[model samples]
Target: MTGGISRVSYSGMLLLGPGTLPLLALLALPLSWVQVGKLNGDVVVQCDTLEPHISWTLNGEQEPMAELVAEGQNLTILGLDLPATGNYSCWAGPVLLDTTYVVVSSTYEEEMDVTCQAESYHGSFHCSWPGPPSAVFRARLTHSDGSVGLWVPVAGGHGQFSVSLADPSFCPFGEELRPLRLHLEGLSDTSYLSLSRHFFLRDIVRPDPPQELTLRWQGEQLHLAWAPPASWQLPKSYFALLYHLQYELPNGTQVERFVEGVEETQVQVGAQRVRISCRDPYTPPAWSPWSPWQDLNAPQ
Candidate 1:
């Protein structure tokens, strides 16, 4: 009764009668400070004072003595489960001491639905995951140099959560000593879950598609030109990218070509359309999504 209560309404007339009022009241109790415990683990709730006659109540009812262990100033909850989660209050002879809203840590089969990506190897990356609609999440990074980062809160909507993180010491040109570790914790009003992933920045790199693409004809030779993705790290020599060019011929035949160490290339004449993608050459072979197709005669 002391916590916040949910507002409820009855129909135009009290068809259920007054006997149901008590049940409705019991379901509207407000929650207080949260205390999360591991599933199936014991949780000890203590009273601040050393009163010998202390007693406890859960959700406005007498605590279930058979399912718990009671000692002076402390109550030990056993085998935490969903049914064991509720507001627990400590009392001493008509005086209220403290209240704790206990919940258990849990996870579902979809808890590991996480994905990460880096646009460039300059050390910043982003990871996202799908979770319960009411959940909040925080993330941290463990860099290749063995340094850990502070928790970074995530932002999301419609059941998806994401966070961006950066490691200041990361070098785009240096060899990686270890994979970076990403740790995530998801919390809800009645439950908590945690997950982790590990990978090198280079492995997760998915550079933006090649930009400013153009086609020119000099007599019989057709030339293709494009600039590296703007998001890619500067100093092209230190952080080179490999490009893939795909085109369609007049006979409906498709041809793909790999262009490395340069952003411009010569292609066979009579190609009708073209698109290009790029990737980090030193990392695992993963190409960026193809750029939008460009028709040869559409315009410059």
Candidate 2:
């Protein structure tokens, strides 16, 4: 025994302890591979040995995925966890006999439902879904014109989590009419998502409704006026603001009027109920919410 490796003679059947797991150890192939299932999985691998002693190691490391106390012809791998996914090799009395590549795999579910909506056309959007707390998620915007945003992660899980996108520049004002589409993707070893949410940006227009709607009877002709809605950003100076004025008459006929440049702050009107919302003509089609209904001035 001078600097030489000794080969153990492999023969026939070898018996183990009464409580040992029964595994069929096939010794035909020079190398064998095994795939283990997830979720408290258990699999048996055949090894080349008829002796009452065997040792296992993962990726040829001192730390083995299988315990060393048990020995013989069968190798029982328990609960093939994600970390258990690797090459499993065993040796009988210092002889590299057979190696079993244990590929840990898991089957996933595909029933994640996503609920999303546009919070602000130019600002951002939102989406959420119920998923495994360990599931990984991502979100993005895909324009009909072929433009796409980066895939962002939707953090948190266990039945709930919300992701908010706050970029208004993705689409210019009024592009709200064309709207944008939101695609949410989820990834995990146990779940899948291949769906997206889309809607008319304008349909979700929820800007703070306009305010300061006033009516004054000015010698037969009524005067109506209001200040523009406030904004999160500095007032855009580009477009003179435009207001959509709607009024219901006593006769039941409703009239909608587009008043440009509300700079004058006053208008001659005669109506029962009136509502007003504003938008930038430069950014036409994207309008703020309608102001609360204002009744006609006295003497209506």
Candidate 3:
């Protein structure tokens, strides 16, 4: 061999040997390397070892605590406060394992409004709210004594539900607690959702009964009149003249008369000299203890 080229006698021909066999062998061997890439949110890549130095970049900045796994540890990169738009890249085993579009969020918040009304009964409040179907909802009441009542239910559905107190016992303010509280189930298991404002329960009261019942003088026309009891709080909407008046004559005789919307203190006496009493229409003469009878000619 002369210079850098060496010739060898093989068979009848001459062969040339390369100058740097050791350097060529070194170039042919593969070295371990990871490809560059990006990822957003969460990603899992399986590789030979968990001890690899995982590095990631958001935009061009390096992630503070990037983790790499071998046995496949879950990677959670939530709540990263990423920009509205950016590039996220990560690497695994000398290869670009992940590349994702970073979408910054303005945050998703929902507002719920609820209104409650009392049914026909007292101390009971009903709440109606709007929400999703298949969503679990709960209600809790705070009594006046600083104690909490167990959650109650109204109706459960996707669009709306009616929730109310389990009993009047949970009503702290009694009839005074107009509207009640309603708590919705938040997305997180441990959190609670309460309506921003409270509603008032409807107070439907009985109307006043007639007063100053009186008997008037008319030749053959006896008229009766009376105002209702004053303590009545119910509305006129429910008020109806609902009583039957009966007249009894001096001969131990009786006459039944029907009156409609009549609160008159006096009724026309058809012909007989008699005494009269009144009874509620809904209650039969048997059920009602008749009102004291008034004699037309009786002295005051």
Cα lDDT, model 3, residue 219: 56
Model 2 Cα RMSD, 1 decimal: 15.1
Residue 257 of model 2 has an lDDT of: 79
User: In candidate 2, what are the lDDT values of residues 249-295, reduced to their tens digit?
Assistant: 87877888787765323343547888887765643266777777888
Candidate 3 stretches greater than 4 Å from native: 1-75, 79-110, 166-180, 186-300
**Minimal lDDT window, size 10, model 3:** 7-16
Greater TM-score among 1 and 3 belongs to 1
RMSD of each: 9.3, 15.1, 27.3
The candidate with the higher lDDT, 2 or 3, is 2
lDDT of each: 0.74, 0.54, 0.40
Q: What is the C-alpha lDDT profile of model 1 across 9-68, one tens digit per residue?
A: 211211111212233533553322456677777787777776778888876678453267
In model 2, residue pairs whose N, Cα or C atoms come closer than 3 Å (at least 3 residues apart or on different chains), thus clashing, are 25-46, 122-168
Ranking by lDDT: 1, 2, 3
In angstroms, how far off is 33's CA in candidate 1? 7.9
TM-score of 1: 0.78
Q: What TM-score does prediction 3 earn?
A: 0.32
TM-score against truth, every candidate: 0.78, 0.42, 0.32
